[model samples]
Target: MATPRQDSSPKGFRPAFYRMKDVIRITSLSRPTLYRRIAAGRFPAPVKLGGRASGWSAQALQAWIDNPSGYAAEPTADDPAS
Candidate 1:
């Protein structure tokens, strides 16, 4: 008899991080617009993944998706309060 495979992640779980391309695709915002929004504190900043690599948190992106116009970036230790 074959054993059943077990799934570790929760149901409907997605990747915890999204690359810039993924973010742009999900938000339907151009690269420039995304950067501008991030600079203006209207979008979530991506977390550093490693050398020269960064990705946005799925939770953060989902929050923005739920309320785009009202979305505000939360300050992180790497970012200075403005």
Candidate 2:
């Protein structure tokens, strides 16, 4: 029998914030696509966690995934943005 793989997410790290690798996994987006969105200001900005570390908020990513169309649409005062 095969053993189940264990989840390795750090316990201290809130699920609301995820590492770049985790964001990639959640979005299933290629590196180029990710970079393109970032450049276009169409995606959430990553937070610098350390000298060489960055992460995106899981809440933001999940919100995007949950309502992709809404995510694509820029925030407007009429829409209240959230």
Highest-lDDT candidate: 1
How many angstroms is residue 75 displaced in model 1 relative to the true structure, after the best TM-score fit? 2.2
Give model 1's TM-score versus the native structure: 0.78
Q: Alpha carbon lDDT of residue 54, candidate 2?
A: 83
TM-score of each: 0.78, 0.63
How big is the positional error of residue 21 in model 2, measured in Å on the Cα after superposition? Answer: 1.4
lDDT to native, each model: 0.91, 0.73
Clash pairs for candidate 1? none
lDDT computed for candidate 1 = 0.91
User: How displaced is residue 10 in candidate 1, in Å?
Assistant: 10
Off by over 4 Å in 1: 1-11
Question: Which segments of model 2 are wrong by more than 4 Å?
Answer: 1-14, 72-82
